[model samples]
Target: MYGPGDVRVEEVPDPTIDEPTDAVVRVTYASVCGSDLHPYRSMAPSQNGRRMGHEAVGVVEEVGADVTALTVGDTVIVPFSWSDNTCVYCREGFNTSCVHGGFFDGAPSATQAERLRVPQADGTAVVIPEGTDESLMPSLLTLADVYLTGYHAAYTGGVSPGKTVTVIGDGAVGLLTVLAARQVGAERIILMGRHTDRTDLGREFGADDVVPERGEEGIAKVMELTGGDGSHVVVDAVGHLPAYEQAYGVLRPGGTISRVGVPQYEEAPVGMASLFGKNATLTGGPAAQRRYLEAALPQVLAGQIQPGRVFDRRLGLDDIVEAYRLMDSREALKVLIRP
Candidate 1:
């Protein structure tokens, strides 16, 4: 990844149940995510060839004896985070940030593999109803990650009817943010993006107006769209310093800014003075994946939102290295691999 082409796919051992609450799944579809690229290519360590991918949908092949909610052969969506519903944080609706059993981070054998050993299956995995069409698998897969994250972004923004919301970034998560905003009855969705195709798709999904600029230029455009008052809610799906600063610039007084993009590092300029001047509220973190999955299931089942449309390319697991290259260069919005 440091030199521009570093992804690799190799045979790995099948995951086995390691706990009474664990489950092993046979992945049917695995998608490469933007978060996976940074560490592989941009981070200082440049960790080479860790098990890639965070989002996937598949069928459970086996479950721990104590796992009661999920059964073998049931189709399910595996969110990027794992949790135990009985934890205090889970009881408070922050299951994503649960202290006991949430977020299986730093493990190389993630959802990208053909088989995944998912801990806390009863709380972390959601079942897809029987009789669901195979063609709809992609959208269902999204409910496991980006779609749910986007929904969390909108939810954290306090979105409701008549609110004007501005979404930064046009990646898959960004576009889904538009869809989630629309679902919550946002009146005006201003999608900020640079690509024609992605912005076009944003319109189809729900963006009322698209701003194709960045930094000060994009800030000016958003101001114009909001009648000089700025949007009521601003969502930051892009996390670098510039994008973070721009997200702050385009919000109205007392508006809420929700951040979903994984911050590249622990520190970044927040422009706290600007936010304080506007009397704005700031929120966002690792998504509450379980909280939103149940909500997205009905929409996906009814075909109200085709979240899977974000995946623009597909390849076999054997072509994994090139798949990462395409994604790293932004040549593909979402890439799926059949392992």
Candidate 2:
């Protein structure tokens, strides 16, 4: 979104499976991501008129002959990045950064399109079990991105039972990070947000406290809720300079900060001062999709996790403009767009 309201549902050629390692998925549910909104707001328009989606859940319409693990009718979650299972990083549990076709190389394109060609099918697509309820699409679809990313944020931050954790954003990923932190057993969840709807869902999903402020003031609230030492872990769900500053500001000395926000231009500077002085750990990236989605699947199937709760509104692909605007304006928490 170079200026605001730049996304449009345009016609593109029907997608086809390009290789034995690829599969064409008929996207059933795709949601607007906070990261997607960055380009629409301040970043420039993509040069390729590219398809704009990274998170989606769909049925395998067609699979390459070599894609033996997935068959037609199998439902799957497409992660933000794609990777070949045999790659070096994949062997190291860093599937998002596989030696071949990593996040940048074979991203495939955004899930906002009607049909998406999933590259590296065996490695990147997490198949949802057969007979999964259709109503779970909104939640299951989230396993592709925000929810999984949230899981990674909490996972990397060392969130666990009895630990006090603070999350740094109220966007869908931030909201899901709260859910992840709670599911992982953070005794106290402090979510940072100014949106009533987001904070409300955070509480429902297990955030013990919500801060309706910004910057240092918000950090103050998180510290207050934690009785002044700050949380044992802080998740910087908002990927920006300000959010990074806030994450550093309120973290207890030595507490870890997990940053998952896509930066302003795919690259941006982050906290270096506090990270070094306090001897705190700061890590950021797209979630380890393959590593976490499998663990998260059963939670959704068992109905223990309602990751779909972040959807404040749902729309058809026809209303892409308004969907972009609502998310860009921060008027909606998460928007689910069906194709």
Candidate 3:
């Protein structure tokens, strides 16, 4: 992205191994994420023609001498963030905060292109099972970011069988949260969203109820659904002031609210009366994708989850600029790009 509202696809040098632990991969599929829209809409200055996109599934074309976990020709999932996986933070399931972790952008390498150079290849990439069908690529690609993030929201929220889980947002991550909730055995999943298209998918993903209302009305509806007790777990997939407040409003006493949405607020109201009285717990941040990729891979491979369906449109890498335009205009849920 060169600046706000500008994305251009131009000829650029192909990626190559830059470190002893780096590897080059041939990207097969890449997708535009909601998070990418943050900078796209921001007034903050950005380097012109910086490579864009963070989610992709590709095959290893080459690996550095020190890389031992993967070899040429292995298919892998490229996560949004790369980490060494041996850092203290990674060992604690916080790979996003790894001391050596960084996003896939600029000179390091980017997934939007036909080729990418992945750092810390052994820890940053998750290899898929051999003989996997090409048709499954879309679903597997989601494991790189959206699915893992949604799963992290549920995982941190303490979702489990019999828990009443409420997901706030109908974006890709929110929709996948519904699926993750079901996988984790959530007995009742409530999805808050207004888009008819997304809501339909939410229902298909196991949402027992849908609340189209927003703010206080939505809060009341959720409280009423729980017999005035509120939900056991709330996943705030929309990171905004009102969304955070709604998540807090509908949380039961001692319940947890997992916020997977990239928060845009600089500050929020979280006083003791609002939290201490209810003992509501607030948790969630950048997902530790590496921790869940392997575990979630089987579900995608088995066809138990299909988050790939969230992509409403598909185009080639050359049309990535239009891909971002579609997502920015809300004309498409998510756009899948093939290189």
Candidate 4:
């Protein structure tokens, strides 16, 4: 990205193994994440464009001598960030906060390209079994960030059987949160979105209701749905302040608000009226993708869930700019990139 609204695809050098723990992956599938829109809309101009994209699934082309878990020719899911799996934070299910971890966005190589240099390969990449069906690639790619992120929101919100979950966006993450909430046993899933097509998918993913209204009206609709008691958990997939306000508004006393969307603003209400008096807990951050990948992978391989269905459009590498535009305009739910 060279500046806000300017995405240029220029040729760059291919990646190679750079460290003893690094591995080079030949990306087969990569996708534009909703979070990418943040920089797309407001990033400062730069002489050298930043590499975009973070979610990818690909084949390992080379591995460092010290990498024991992955070998050449292995297919792997590269999470949004890299980390040493043995680090204290990684062991505790917070790979994003690993002592030696960093995100792919500012790295020397990013997943949007045809190749990526993955640091800490053994700890960051999840190897897929050989001969897995190619059709599952999209689903597998979600394991890198989107699906796991939704799952993280529910996990942090303490979603469980007999609980009501209110997901505050109809984007891919929100739709998948509905799926994750259902998988984790949430009895009722309410989705807040204006788009019928996206909200329709949310319903297919197990949303019990969709609130097309916004602001106070939206909050009232959700509260009405919950019989004025509010929801047991509110997953804010949209990071703007309004989304956060809606989250608190519909949160049942003692319920949790989990925010998976990267926040666009820093200031928010945490005072008595918003949280303190209600004893509401605020949690969620960059997903522990490596940690959640373990459980989500098998389910995708088994065909029990098709989170990839969230992808509504497909574009080749050369059309990435259009892909971004489609998403920015809300014309595309999510776009799959074929490199």
Better of 2 and 3 by TM-score: 3
Q: Given candidate 1, what's the lDDT at residue 289?
A: 82
Score residue 308 of candidate 3 by CA lDDT: 89
Residue 79 deviation, candidate 3, in Å? 0.8
- Against the true structure, whose lDDT is highest? 4
How many angstroms is residue 216 displaced in model 3 relative to the true structure, after the best TM-score fit? 1.1
TM-score of each: 0.95, 0.93, 0.96, 0.99
Q: Which ranges of candidate 2 are over 4 A from the true structure?
A: 1-4, 104-109, 265-273
Candidate 1 on 1-339: residue-level lDDT in tens?
333355556676788998989999999988888777667666454545455577778899999999999989999988888888778888887887777565543464587788998888999889999999998999998887888889999999998998999999999889999999999999899999998898899999999999998889999999998889998999988777777788789989999999998876577544657787778888998888877778779888998889999999999877878788788788999897777
Per-residue alpha-carbon lDDT of model 2 for 1-339, expressed as tens digits? 223456667777878878889889888898788887766766555655445767788889999988888989998888878888677787777787787655522244557878888888987788888898988888888888888889999898899887998888888888899988988899999888888877888888888888888887887877777788987888888778888878878888888888888755454434466777777887768788788777888988989898998888999989978888888888888899888
The per-residue C-alpha lDDT of model 3 at residue 105 equals 52
Cα error, residue 158 of model 2, in Å, equals 0.7
Q: Which 10 residues in a row give candidate 3 its minimum summed lDDT?
A: 43-52
Residue-level lDDT tens digits of model 3 in 141-162: 9998999899999999999998
- Candidate 2 at residue 26, lDDT? 89
Candidate 2 clashing pairs, residues 3+ apart or interchain: 1-39, 1-40, 52-110, 53-110, 53-111, 161-185
- Can you tell me which runs of candidate 1 are displaced by over 4 Å? 1-5, 44-49, 269-272
Q: What do the candidate models score in CA lDDT, each in turn?
A: 0.84, 0.81, 0.91, 0.94
In candidate 2 the C-alpha lDDT for residue 233 amounts to 89
